[model samples]
Target chain A: MDAIAEKKPVAFNRWLPYWAVFQADVRQTLRSWVYLFWVLLSVLATVGYLLYRFGSYHEGGIVQTASVHVSQLLRWIVLGSAAIVCVLTAGSITSERGTMADSVLSRGISRYQYFLGKWHARLATVLGTFLTLGIATLISALFLLHEDLSLDGSLVALAVVAALLTTVITFGVTVSAVANSTVLGIAVLWSMLCAAGFLMSFLPPRYPSPDRTLERLPYILQGNYDLAGLAQFAGWSLLASGVAALFGLGYFSRRDV
Target chain B: MAENSSSNMVVETFKLTKIYQNRQIALNDVTLRLEPGCVLGLLGSNGAGKTTLLRLIIGLHRPTAGWAKVFGKFMTPNAAELRRRIGYIPTNPQFPRGMTPITYLDYMARLFGLPKDVRKPRLASLIRAVDLLRVSGDSIAGFSNGMTARLAVAASLINEPDLLIWDEPTHGLDPEARRSMLELIKTLSREKTLIVSSHNLSDIDEVCNHAAVLSHGQLIYCGSLQDLKGRMRRNHFELDLEGEQKAITKSTTAIRALPEFKVVTLKHRRLELYLQEEVGGAAALANVLMTLNDNKVTLVSIRSVGQQTEQAFLDLVEKEESRGFARIYQAEAA
Candidate 1:
């Protein structure tokens, strides 16, 4: 046999791994058993909650307001999916921990690209689910239930809940990247969620946190909320997510695969 | 540090150390330089840090105290371009679940940024090469250990890396799969710089010209295979004879009377012996043939069977362990 010639790395395009990661992770997230269960459960809960609202209003001889409709739509769909979302995002890093070493460590793939790809894929899932459920519930409340829910109120409520969901997903992914085990990541995320809620309750309502923003989501949707407080909360929440994202990226880059 | 980047060197580690979780000193102060072309056999017992060292060189695990350079650049976790030149087969590879070989290889090729045109043909060729053509469309979850290992081999070569670092490539393979893998390594050794870490010293003896033996996280021996064998002061021999049992029994006495020979065992015209340092088995075997002068006795096949590299490795590890005990003894005494 002739001597094997020495080889060089391919003149690789930098963005390939990032895009591949995003595409593969999107498939993985959508096909996961938990995600399938989540979709089914979310649809059932939203439909049930809508029917119950109509039944309650009819029985009490009271009209369902726009704020009530929007609030409960979120309560049933977004908040209901939060635990399953946490599970999906928390295992995002830990689940890949063993397999990724074979591919990511052996190639020209950046941790930044990998981290962002996974982050963006799960982020897409959260936003996509929220929008789909929000639109469906809005139509149901408007036509079928004859509830007085406004388009502006529904959109505003969906956007705020979307931002808050983004924060939760980002935090969950970061915790997964930082912790060594999926169990640990899930525990830390649940703790952070609880801590955020508990800590925000201690703060005055004028400068509301994201957790506080959710509590008064109805008032916020009705435009009775303080605009200055909403902006501050949005900025702080984004800054926190940004910091966590940077930390998770840096930590993951140095972590042993 | 300058010599590490000297183009001819494929891998270099200077005082490279790794202490995992502040408790296990997985690899300690291992310094070596591997030139291009030599297939280095990494021989170490379980937990001797073979995996740790390989991981360090590939930039999967960072060095705690020193550094490693692969292809002239310091290997870091984020050294994407440098890492692109390395093909690593991790121990018991856990491939992405729910993916067929075709999809997995496609994913791997894309990670290395191969274009659709280049990626398709390459995956096809590699699948054929590793004999995974039949299962190319099957999910990796259904693959046996042998199949998964073959897929991993294909994945490693996706980018045509300059250096191949394989950790226990045949750890769980059946004999057939193991033999095929060894044959593949032998073929690949003609061209690429490979570091194969395995406990199968016989396989190492077959394919590797250079050997590195690690004992308890320390480099006990590192040099050419000939040099490692040269350190052995005793020689081993095995022989088969075509003769009557009576003739063979009589010849054994004459063989034992020879000054240089020590008969280890003799049974049914077969013989095993060891010789003292220097004369080795060849000269001693000649003397034995001269002494077995019975016309009824004849040599069928005579092989100056040398001590396998396995023996050398065991001797090396045994010696290192004793020294370790000695040092601890002294420390306790102090």
Candidate 2:
């Protein structure tokens, strides 16, 4: 039998090689017209939301509380910006199956590295987009709406949004890895997101009461030294994202590309 | 497995087989061993499992039974080091739409862990080698089929892989491009082990020293090109006559009566003769001419006819088809 003993010792961090793929993917995402279109749409939506908020303030001739304005901005960022994230990530793997994987994978990059690279690259883009929108919204709220936003509440909300974006992007990556085509991956993700939204619409009021331990995980982990609803939301979001990422990696590694 | 463990061997497969989810037996009981520094031409018709075997060797598809080893290592999903020694170009290789040849190769180089200093000059030399220096900076999306093929070739060589697998490298090229590609392949074969799978017989004849022919997922022939040709060579000759039909008929009968001629057929003024295995070419020709001359027959022309590689390939495939084997087989039985 062959020696099989000359196997190169794996490096300390095996995933380090994935950085190259990540960088290439990031460049691809930036150059894509789809990303440009989504970025523009997000910006325009943010601007529209700001205009509507300013109009409400002007018409009522009263300054709304900072929490109300922050809540509205968070809703738009999560709903509107997350939609763009889904679209951007939905084709991350499927589009590359025929076009690039044959060449790239044959060069000795493992499926796990490729999947992880794409995952991290797309997550960076989505998170950057969310941060930019969040900052812009905060600046606009403080300057135009003239409300004193609480720093603690704003940070917690940002953390919650970050967790939510992570979950959506990971789920989108899973869909991308499983589907055979970009269109199919996008359609599947869109349908699932719609289904989740439909289901969430029926939740009862006060579903997570103040006394519930499940409602207090995110704040507990955020160094806020408190247990609250945002903490629980963050915990659940991380768990879902972790499970989706694992599933994507497992399926991608076993299936022929 | 023990017999195939030589360091010189670049690839080895033992009873490798692949069955699709739809019950299509893509490859069955394929046992092959390839040494370094040879161009292996993989020949077969459509659905003959040429691509399937190549994919299995490259670890793109898992074998349903048995396995393959590359660079003395069993192929696996995480065979990164093993795969680093190989470069593969798929049929009709496609790249991301916006990348130029330069950028694309650069990315590939990085994936192979080539440092920046080495990558720059290597990319430049490969671009010049493929004669793509002129358009190396242009987006590959706008390249023609020949240009894409050239880029694929260049990309495959970016890492200086020990083995290169090209699936129909010249399938869609124009005549000039095809010629250039063949020349490129010939040049690369000097230093690297190559597995070129193609349908064009002339291309194989031009560049390959050895060949493996597949039929219905079975390896019908695998050996040196010269050996394959030798196995299919025939002791045959064609004769043209310029005499009366009576004289021609008499000469044909005389030739058939000779023990040297195993089979003879006459059509109009032309005669085809197959010499007995024991008869040498020179002696057989002399005997036929002497017989014709004695029969008052005027011989217009005579030429020996040997089977070409294409003829041999067709004959092998036709023979396999006539056997009428089922398309699917049990994994263990295969």
Candidate 3:
């Protein structure tokens, strides 16, 4: 009891639990075979593209070369990693047998912290894999393409892709937090994503659809994309993510662990 | 109402109830208060709501009706500050995959916001204390049930919590592990308030002063362990008598002829005396021994079974069930 009284003054950081969950979850996800397989695929695809590009000499304009190269890297991340993220995050809460109960029941953590901590951990890891591929492609593209790429364009394009991945993961974790079974979570998440993708495709470019984002990436990287559309899409993407996050937090906080 | 009611108690439940989604009453109308320095042993048969009651107190499961207060504050999912003063271990405790004992305990310490100066040393000491130093670096995935249970114990203690709540702390443990765990609980009982839930009555009898029994999601008994044991209607007595076969047989035959001593059995050189409720325990036991001595039989040993706690618990549950308490929750009736 005296020890506890002494500890009372040690400055308990409110965010420490969230950070702990984030760090541990990132470590776990990075070491998992499934996430590792996705990492390997993204790596191999980027390397294979670089080999093909550098193997032959072509004066294709820097814009075109960079666009195609960006597409190649983003191909694995935006298109392929969606399902991988679903598999990885859809069970973030539901798959836990008793670990969630154990951690939350212990000293100093709210279920909200645990849920958000895991949510961001998935965000960081999936984005981490994306960054690995993005940087590798950009570094290689600078030397092989032998043209001054638009730095602003590349950053913007990368940010958009990052935003897209974040949305995918947010919804995936939302499904995880809501569903009681990992398998069921995966099914619901994929269906939600597919339905959202379909709806976005039919709507105008301002709707922030995955297809629209990917389709406009070349122009975005060339600095010729529509700014109004980008702003609208960014706002809408952010709003969608916020809504998903709120729903997850609400349900997870109120429901039984 | 809950806040003002249990200010002086370590744990207070006010008509606490929990009904699962399927309309199953996992806990019903359980109201009890525990003073500080009290070690409460939760007892029940299978599906007896022991886990449910503990979970409700720990704020793991929201009650369907009523509420619980720990340390004078209401229990809720977001009550981090309140929970910080409590250490909890769920039944069949599970640790996250891809972590070793060292890493997991460290994570638990960090969850409590322990500074590095405290967290690092504390985690190191806990791992060694739990006898996990040998496997400190190995992945927890390979640990046995006993090893995992030990790690769970370490995790629960990382915060130096004032109140410890454990659900089935000795469950699934091998004999040696179970003995060691009960010893740990007994030692901690001297310093902190604890609520331990288990079906093992002797474990409770050994470590707890206060006891609560549940049957079919309803509290059947709550008070001192001695009081609960005292509820038994009759008592058992056993003896080892050494003498000539005819002498022992003649002594046992005379004892068996008593009207009050309904259960008397003799085999080999041992005699068992079961005193009915109407029989005076001390007088009946004395008469039997005197008869043996008068017959020139040597009293090698004499003892009474310590299983009265088990029998007393069974009696409570049976009494509750006999009132048709379970029939109220039957699915067909619902």
On lDDT, the leading prediction is 3
Compared with the true structure, the alpha-carbon lDDT of candidate 1 equals 0.81
Q: For residues B164-264, could you state the per-residue lDDT of candidate 3 as single tens digits?
A: 99999899999999999999999999899999998888899899988899887878888888898888765677899888999999999999987668789
Candidate 3 per-residue lDDT over residues A19-58, each given as its tens digit: 9988988887888887998888777877887767766546
Candidate 1 similarity to native, TM-score = 0.90
The residue ranges of model 2 lying beyond 4 angstroms of the native Cα positions read A1-17, A59-62, A81-83, A194-228, B1-8, B233-236, B240-287, B295-307, B325-334
Indicate the docking level reached by candidate 1. medium
Per-residue CA lDDT of model 1 for B1-334, tens digit only, reads: 1243456688988888999899999998888889888899999989999999998998878899898988878988888778777788988888777899899989988887787877889899999999999888888998899998999999889877779999889989999999999999998888899999998888899889999988878887889988888776556667788767878888887777777865457977788887865575667767777766553687778665645687788778876777755744432342
Task: List model 1 lDDT by residue over A1-257, tens digit each.
Answer: 69897654456778888899889989988889988898888788778777787786778666776566667668656566778888989999887876565566567777778889899988898779778877887777775464555566567777777777888889988998889889999989988888887787788756666556677767755657565666677677677789888889989888887
Q: Which candidate is the best by DockQ?
A: 1
Candidates arranged by TM-score, highest first: 1, 3, 2
> Model 1, DockQ value?
0.62
Instruction: Mark the regions of model 3 whose C-alpha exceeds 4 Å error after superposition.
Output: A1-9, A53-64, A97-100, A146-149, A204-208, B1-5, B144-146, B239-248, B276-302, B325-334
Tens digits of per-residue lDDT for model 2 on B57-86? 988778899889888788876687777778
Instruction: Please report, as a value between 0 and 1, the fraction of native contacts recovered by candidate 2.
Output: 0.54
Give interface RMSD for all predictions: 1.7, 3.3, 1.7
Clash count for candidate 3 is 0
